[model samples]
Target: MKSDMTKGNIAPILIKFMIPLFIGNLFQQFYNMVDTLIVSRFVGADAMAAVGATGTIMFLILGFANGLATGFTVLTSQSYGARDENRLRHSVANAIILAVIVTVITTFISVVSMKGILRIMNTPDNIFDYSYAYIITIAYGICASVFYNLGASILRAIGNSKVPLYFLMLSAGLNIVLDLVCIVGLDLKTFGAALATVVSQGISAILCFVYIYKKQHSIWPEKRDWHLEARDTSHQLRVGIPMALQFAITASGTMIMQAAINLYGSVAVASFSAASKLQSLITQGMPSIGQTMAAYAGQNFGAGKYDRLKGGVKNALIIMTVYSVVAAILSTSLLEPAMYLFFGSAENVAIQLPWAIPYIRFCAICYIPLSAIFIFRNMMQGCGFGFLPMMGGVVELVSRAIMAALSMKFMIYELASACDPAAWLTTGIFTFVAWLYVAPKIERMFSGRQKVID
Candidate 1:
């Protein structure tokens, strides 16, 4: 069901909305982690390395598509919060048109360039084929992933996060079954994992499209609204292009980091892969709160409720800090068992744990700063302060790139582990600066409102 977030208690609403989003993100991460889990255990370490090798590439390509879709939703969220039904419909229609364009362009470019991209990442010869197989399979299915992201973002924009969560649960469950069948039963290996993801995403996308078109009347576009206007399209691109570039820019840093890890050979690659997967599993709450803040801030911003917007941010930081401490504790306790589970042997554990454990520890304890970066950055994006957050992405890119380059000089793996924290710290500072700058401007909007009344 569609709910309006323009009114009501901000904290409770944010928590309620964030729970579903957090769970939904869990399923989404589970969707990817399952692939690595199955591949590592069933297919051998090389296969796991192959899958890991494509991680940054997938982020680079799919990240851009997902970013564009996410950017488009901000406009829809603002329109929904303001109760401008006409503008909401047009925003949805234009977003759909834009998604189509992005899907085609991204799929073609990523699929054709997969080999060269892998080479640039310094993927070792032994694992190159496995990585290529996985990347190509997923590349072909890029449209499915892009569509699902667009559909889900739109749903969340209208305060309908529950439906997307439901769909995601279904997709995650289905992908696991397929992973078992394809990777374990049929022995399709890396290709199988990628294929499972694509098929599951396609089903989720279809469900989202059906529900939005047939069920949700509030934000559905009519035939007349389907006609895209140059000005509106420009407006979306204005908001969306930066959002897209932000993700691409951030992914570039990760890609650089991955490239550095690649130079350490497959042992390092596989270790990083398993550790990163585990990190993603535990750290879902960080991004979930950030996403919830985005929607909450968007609605409050649209309604000219600047005070409520600040409340949302304050509550989110409190929640984020508490969760960060809890997650760090849990991660420290479970890190070893999780590693053993992922690799499944004392021998494999011995090899991977050295690199994986310290990296996870560095990341786990640093969640406070990490959470700040995501919340403040996304809050700005929600308030339609897209450019500053985009600049935060730039800060992430530069910081991570510097660390990745510097990690090459150090023999200690902790240097590499420190990269993310450094990036998060700098990015958090950038985002706070952005929030400080944007807050005054937003306050001035309310000032204008009071003057109008006077």
Candidate 2:
């Protein structure tokens, strides 16, 4: 809502902003992918599988928290655009207070239920220890994750994407260093990866707050700014809860999928994990444009610049759609080489390569429609229609459940029929199904409201 991403020379400005965001997000995935890469290379495929084991659960809780913060970011951006300093300050204070409580509660819940959560997912017997250790270690540091996201969202809200990107860059470098040292030098194994991530996130969060306090003129919060009314907190939760819940539901669906993956045995688990790691390397940049669109939509909508808001959405679609197609093409052509680089053992590589090819190709296509969903959610959230994003989440959850169930049945069918293509087909079919559900909704959101957004 702060920077007018829609107003400038569209091509040049989009390139400038989105490039940094794209690079930063790619590096962010590097923090994650490094774990799988190093562990698979060093600790054995089982250890890598252990790291993979935590993914859906981690995405579940972490996604919800980040989504909640993003909602606050959109709100703060609009408040700042309207030059309502008091509301911005209030938003910041309340966000901090709320995030702290949620972090603590989530930490307690996650830690206490770590084993149960893993059990529900039917995480492979061999990798259970690594999963538990990783989950517990990260949950213990949930406070750091919360702070980092809250701070980053604050920076983005006030049009300081570069600042958070800078902090994340710093954190990513630190993460790489720590990951290597922890696993290789310290021999902390899976725990080391979680520790490295937590420590890096904490440092970034702390640095972010310091930066916000000193330099963000519109966002500086005084002691008196800390008091929050129940209604306002509820209001933030109202806007934020659905976002958080959306992630939770998606994660739950993924957890089911994770259980299904585990049913396929260690080779299947390891192969799927390798592909997920590699694909994230390409697809993670979608959020940058999504967030950019959200900011543009929020600022203009707040200023009642409806025409610009409409134009901005069109601009975002053009930008993200092109990238998604390119990503799909690259993934299809390069899937084998990428697998060779990231995975291990002749058997492991062979098992993973085929599965990755079809899954990523489908993802590339999904990215096309999916990008529109992200842009629309952010746009809707920016326009103060926060609940639309929640509806999207529900759609995602339902589609995901259907996809996973069908995929599993397909997997079982393949087993019985001696059809090896079942796994890859399951993936491609699900990817298409997701896009099918998501694309129609995005088209509907803008079909009648085709006023150009700023």
Candidate 3:
């Protein structure tokens, strides 16, 4: 299961690695999508809106956890590529230590701040309690999310994407079953949905840990691996904190946009929420490819295959560009129908569709820039240039803040809809430029080292 990305034809290997990652990503998204669908259908539209309202905040906290876990794995991947088994084991062990600390911090902050965040977003009085219950429950489950991401990330770091995908698939199915049992059978509503997600992810995390312990001997930590060195911790934090902050910053922008949307009341919030879910589903492939590039670039960079890394980036761009076009067509064509999946009542669908459709279409049309953001930014992260990507996230936060402010000032719902595409455009351009500047320096540095060796 441990494959080497540094030695294959660029496009085929990338695609092969990418397909499982894309599918796994889809299944991961399904956890939330299913929660929304079950909550909307059984508990009512208000309940669905409550769950939806929590989306950005969930992204803020949980995204930081996942991003940190991923950043930890970059070192693992590099160690794998360089054939440093000792370093890989140490990286994995240190990552676990950091993840535990992060889990405790993230869970406490998110749970304690949950209600205040909702108030800041101006959540409607109608759904305030439902939103609070749902998100706070999710906040309590941060450990599950963090460890699952950490485990899956380690598997992917060594070119073993399939095991994580298999476990994710199993957990996703369990999530649906548990959603129904709790939401419908037990009548738990939004709280139940959050609980189901947490439990399912916890199971996945446990399974991944078991697999690594039993099967992945190459990089598995021995007794000595547990002796954490300051250097190893520093290395993980150097990449992890910037990566985590990048996600947190982007989510902060989303929180800003959500606050502006909240000004329009629950109807707009519900519409945007439903549309956003559909868009995430449709464009899952972009991020999947981005993740693929991370591993691909990380491995090659570690192996000193700078030319191959460049080739992989080029191939990844081509793949993402083509996928973006298809995703656009799918979003515009399928979005209206997809709304029904969340809202069973025709009246509710009618109320939300008019507001939701344009937003989905606008984002769909601008998928290229969004796609570019994922590809280039992740490639940079994989290559150990984490700071610029974090700066790109800052650019995104500023763009969304500006748009959200404008939307609120003028009461134009349309401007709020434009926030995402605007952020994507600005962030995408910034990251691409950063890549251009960084890629040359990397190549030149490695080339000179090779010359010195010669």
Candidate 4:
């Protein structure tokens, strides 16, 4: 476990580690995809659309929680790499503690804000109750989501990637079964979808925490460590806040796009939402690499293995580029079936197909650049280039604003119909805007890194 950070063939090592991470991520996301599948197949299109309707808002709230856990993962990876057992335990303990805090706050806000947030997304009046009920149910389990994330991250840091993956597979399987029973067999509808999601997540989280408590030597804490040290809390907050807010900013921006899509009605909403669920599978690809990079970079950086960090990034870029191209080819070929899978067989895939296809195809192209942004940022954060990562986060937040301000009017003038040209615009041009914003900042950081070495 310890050797993964500093030794072994870097490329194969990363790929081997990330395969499970990717599979786990796929399964993790598969939990919801299964629901979308079952819902589209049996519960009817409007119900499926109702569930999809809340995705952006979910990202807004869930993304913030994820960003904070990301910070904790960085700290843990670094501590583990340094082989500083004391620091490792401290970070792990605090990560769990921090997860509890963020979870409670987010769950509260999500529940309270569910209806307004849905309304602001301009969800049609008919879908409003379903969105509210689904979101609130999903929010009830935010703590579980964080529990799984934080614990799984710790496992990854210490090179136990497979355990988390196993847990995710088990829980996701449970989710599929429950989803089938709720939405397919019993006819529970949107609220059933939400229940399935939360229960699945809760199962995974509880088992992971219990196993860590009982088994993992890496996470054991002394009584004194229970209360977080001042420096630890301060650093976690400093780093976590920007990371969390980056997601918040991006998620909030997405919420705006969701509002616009809603104005087009349930079909447009269904198309966008269905494509999004399908697209989630693709985005998880390189991000699996980015995550592995996070642990690899952080652990190496903390141990001062600077050369390994350099090698890891080079390998990451090569792999991500190849993947982007391959995914583009596959998505282009599978476009019809993929959309058909989410929208169901009976429905005319044509209605949603064109909409899902272009947006996903655009993603396949932008994915590399987006991944380039992630690799550098994850490395920078892992290395505790604290303020620089935050600066990059600022770039992402600002670019979304820039993209929206400039693009909406043009989109209104252009496609301007139920066809959803905005999907391409939202995920594509907006992403390019962010890439432009981040590129120069990342270049400056590396330039400074070179200076420090010289």
Candidate lDDT scores, in order, read 0.87, 0.72, 0.90, 0.72
Where model 4 places Cα greater than 4 Å from the true spot, the runs are 1-3, 345-347, 401-454
Q: Give the TM-score of candidate 2.
A: 0.88
Better of 1 and 4 by TM-score: 1
Best by lDDT: 3
User: Can you write out model 2's per-residue Cα lDDT over 381-410, one digit (the tens) per residue?
Assistant: 666665556655655555556656766777
Q: Which stretches of candidate 1 lie over 4 Å from their true place?
A: 449-454
* Each prediction's TM-score versus the true structure: 0.97, 0.88, 0.98, 0.88
Model 4: ten consecutive residues of lowest lDDT: 413-422
Ranked by TM-score, the better of candidates 1 and 3 is 3
Total clashes in model 1, counting residue pairs 3 or more apart in sequence or in different chains: 0
Stretches of candidate 3 off by over 4 Å are none
User: Cα-based RMSD of the predictions, in order?
Assistant: 1.4, 5.1, 1.0, 4.1
Give the least accurate 10-residue stretch of model 2, judged by summed lDDT. 413-422
lDDT of 4 by residue, 174-230 (tens): 998998888778888877888888888888888877877788765667776777778
lDDT of 2: 0.72
Angstrom error at residue 38, model 3: 0.8
Sorting all predicted structures by TM-score, with the top scorer first, yields 3, 1, 4, 2
